[model samples]
Target: EAGRRNLLGLRFPPKYGGRGLRWEDEIVAIGRTANTASLNADGLGIKLGEHGEVHVNASLQTTIPHIYAIGDVIRGAGLAHQAMAEAELVVEALQGAQVDATSLIVPACIYTHPEVATVGLSEEQMRAETDAVIVGEFPLRASGRAVTCNEVEGWVKIVGDKRTGKLRGVHIYASHASELISEATLAIAQGLTIDQYVKQVHPHPTISEALGEAGWVALNKPLHVPRIQRKRLRK
Candidate 1:
């Protein structure tokens, strides 16, 4: 049945087994399943002592100021990009640039089917922390480029601070979402407002426009999605 569904390019409903799992959850499930099957998992590593990771301060300095740590050894998502960012922070600090390492926004991406990528807080997290949150979403099905590529399987979501109009997060679940997330990461990291993001002109009929469209939707100024559809998304 699953094979037939795949052959027909049809996905089962989530209740039966469609795309129901979050990217992180899927990774954990794969690791656990691999362990159960006694497979040599790529993530298997040395079980370090109780104080495994060397704790770092805002300046990336370890508990002992003289020592410093970065990359996978630190308590982070362990992505190469994160390591590179931390490395730059450390270099700036060394050069007496007065860097604040904690301010860095590390973007994460899961390169799965209909890639998942995100930067900053999620809707759930933002809602829990603050009531004044605005969410805007652009379904890929409405995107010209997505339809052209026949990869309109997901959406792009932007979470903003309603009171401040500052972009708080950007999440994408679509083809090339990993690449699309960088723009959002920059927006969030630089504290760009929704207006600022939307004002910039995005090339027509491109996946990148999804981000801009989402920004407009959050502000209740959608251009592509009909009013009825907008209302449904707001709900």
Candidate 2:
């Protein structure tokens, strides 16, 4: 079983949960990953689906018994953090633990300058799925810390259900946006309301404060952006 388990590994360079490139031409031989199943998966009794992803049950187990799959082999954003979470979940499952899918809130981050990060539904997605939606967007120009670091070039937008006040999604486009999104992910995972999120008292003058500002803006109780800007924003 140990040898078979080793054969199931389709990952390369485990330091990160990402796809390894494969060249079709005979000129090169590379390991494929993320969207494609291992070359040996079919012969080993595993099923492949869209984009050549490994098919798994609700328990994350593959078609073959005792052979679970996770990380890039499964369907997801191919993110390292998400893969790590899946790894932990697989471990728990093997240990006879039962967990709900909602227990996992996978946050996506892009490590570029003025990084990009997001979690949960988008405004368009939320609008289509719910009756009413409200959005609060705060820009970096309003962040004192952004000015201090000369990184004022983006905004944070939060979407919520107007009736329930529950946050539907959180999007960030700013410096350290990747780092700032964790709090938003946690809020969404816990179903925190916009009011509850805003009242948390973010530390003064940091990019993270924008999250609180966005929540306040969503509630129509402006914190730092002011009424004049709010009026202009609506226009």
Candidate 3:
């Protein structure tokens, strides 16, 4: 049954996120990504870590101080957006603005059949960092958008600090997880709590709505999933 549904989806991809995209004009590849840093500062004598990634300071400077390194050359998620953010920070530092080279809000995504997108701390990482944590999940099966697309195999999970109600992370496994995660990244980066996040309205009949629903589930004021299930979501 799962196989049939997946094959059907591949044959006729749904226009998720309200875009008029077509699978007929797409190229697909399957493989593991082995990304390495691009370093050309050899003659300049740049210091490298054990893994050979360039070592930089809070200002993204090499051991030489005058030199700077950003993007894949440094230890990070090796994402283009991350590299761009680092570049912007570097430019600000050069202009004498206070900047933090480290501590980037890098969101990751696996662009597969059921895309995986996430930002902020994971449940395990959150548990280790904070004393209290709560997780709220909204299954794709419960989403009206998912039902319309006939692809309801994944879920959206939200992690938050129970004490402060501040949203810690957003993890999504759905068709347009990549497209849906930008909002989550902003929320986590700005340190918006569940209370603040849920106050913003999500449009009806959309996959993004599941994120708000997950927040509601976390606050024990769920409007989509079973109310009793919210208890087991906390740690």
TM-score winner: 3
C-alpha lDDT values of all predictions: 0.78, 0.78, 0.82
**Model 1, total clashes:** 0
lDDT of 2 by residue, 132-191 (tens): 888888878789999999988788899888888888789998988888888899899899
Task: Put down candidate 3 lDDT per residue, 146-231, tens digits, no spaces.
Answer: 99999887788899999888999999999989999999999988889999998988888899999998998888888878888543
TM-scores for all predictions: 0.78, 0.79, 0.80
Separately for all candidates shown, the number of backbone clashes (residues 3 or more apart, or on different chains) is 0, 0, 1
How many angstroms is residue 193 displaced in model 1 relative to the true structure, after the best TM-score fit?
Answer: 0.9
36, model 1: CA deviation in Å?
26
Better of 2 and 3 by lDDT: 3
- Against the true structure, candidate 1 has what lDDT? 0.78
| Residue 108 CA displacement from its true place in model 2, Å | 0.8
List where candidate 2 sits over 4 angstroms from the true fold. 1-39, 226-235
lDDT for position 217 in model 1: 91
Return whichever of 1 and 2 wins on lDDT. 2
Q: In candidate 3, what residue range of length 10 has the lowest lDDT sum?
A: 8-17
**lDDT winner, 1 or 3:** 3
How does candidate 3 fare on TM-score? 0.80
